[model samples]
Target: MSVTPEAAARLRAYLAYFRDLGVHEFYRWSEPAAQALEPAAAVEAPAPSIAAATGVLPPATPPVVAPPLEIDDRELQPAHMLPPSLREPPAPALRSFDDLVPLPATTIPAADRPAALKVIQDEIGDCTRCPLAYGGRRKIVFADGDPNTELMFIGEGPGADEDAQGLPFVGKAGQLLNNMINAMGLKREQVYIANIVKCRPPANRTPEYVEASTCSQFLIKQIDVVQPKVIVALGSTAATYLLGRKQALAGLRGSFHSARGAKVAVTYHPAFLLREPRMKGEAWKDLQMVMRELGLKPPVKQ
Candidate 1:
């Protein structure tokens, strides 16, 4: 019988496997051996059997199932995942409210030296604690004189001159104030001068009720700190701020009022003297009253 090319190749492979199993040659023992192998030889040979008594059987292999390929869906998205270079920086750590140190209270202690002045200064700088803060320049003109002085001159709010210089009594009215101080035989430094409201009203108008109320605390604290034997409230606003009433200046003047437990006397504002220069006589009289109350010498006649 003739063998096809495929059968010849199968026979070669089977022969090679038999050689590896130490079977160099084969001989047919009987007709049954030839008949039994003939069908297998026509097809691919079975793998060698471990036992020679048993016929060779092909090795059974399990079917291999490959894993499905992963396709990234990001390419189809409108927004792409940021590359390492394009990634955002980490946000800064937030500070905890608990971690913040609380600021010390700014309340002025009664009769404390520079501490009281410091409180006044700090309050004056940004004193919105009152409505007056809205209508004036950035700063409130707190008094600038001896904080320890026994005499204090309390005035109304700042005028054009006082506001510009950040000092009390620096205009024509301030000139008059200096004359009045000198006439009473006292230097400006010997007396401490302040205003009811540290800031000036618009167009030198009288301070409003709300503004005066706001600045009242500062004036009271000032009185406590100065511990002055006598206080001269320079105008109606000053009188109102100290006394909490808007009485006529004439009635309020020439009388004693209590301010932070100190003796207070109301008098015309220096600016009022500018408007009514004749009032200087009355102002001088008020200054004499102040001197007499404080045991100071009376003004010498010119």
Candidate 2:
């Protein structure tokens, strides 16, 4: 059976991420696995790290000898596409809202989410399904982060650098976000970052009503894939859509709201704070709520 094109696209995005992490060299796969799943031709670099500029990792896992990464081509194919003799048995049905959180109650067994998320990304392939597709944009910026992370950040859409690089953030605004995450005693890779729409709107404008509505389904799927303990809506665009209504950021900014079964907090965009640096303090207040929720320590003053 052929691996669904949808699944293969994600494999590319996923591998591209590993490539960015500088850890791709630690492993290798057999030629068939490489040929079957190589997304090298499709995706460029993994979505840039808009959360943390550089990772703060635990001591590296001691290297151990292992068998060559040789996966069966049959395993790559989705069950629906496989022949009767090759098709594997279907797994048990997930309980209602099971997809919202991990099995056994929002914990371990992230349910192979990386692969599932890759499938979702593929489903959105070369997305001409909307008017936003036709733009000076080079590539669609899907998302960035560990698929199984516990904290997430969602913003409006791709900006100039983001569009050019095919990654979210990665501009002056992204640098500010990096500082925010660092202040919370967290690393960028510890949380997930995504935007409402994958494509960049013309002239960096806000995504249209139809655009946001259409791209939102993918965002919901992304949220479910991450199962975060809390999500910080990075601006009014993020807040308005995540909560599903038009409202001022003032009314929505100070407290926790619910969306896709995750605790949502609204805050100003980094780009806004750049123009109004005084507001960084206010943004910090919102981020502090995120820290408390995650039981993170405040950065001690030097």
What's the alpha carbon RMSD for model 2? 28.0
What's the TM for model 1? 0.59
CA-only RMSD, every prediction: 31.6, 28.0
Question: lDDT of each prediction vs. the true structure?
Answer: 0.70, 0.80
> Candidate 2: which pairs clash?
52-188
Error of 1 at 13 (Å): 99
lDDT of 2 by residue, 159-199 (tens): 99999899887999998998898899887887899998999
Local accuracy of candidate 1 as per-residue lDDT tens digits, 183-219: 8788898889988778888878887766766676666
> 136, model 2: CA deviation in Å?
2.1
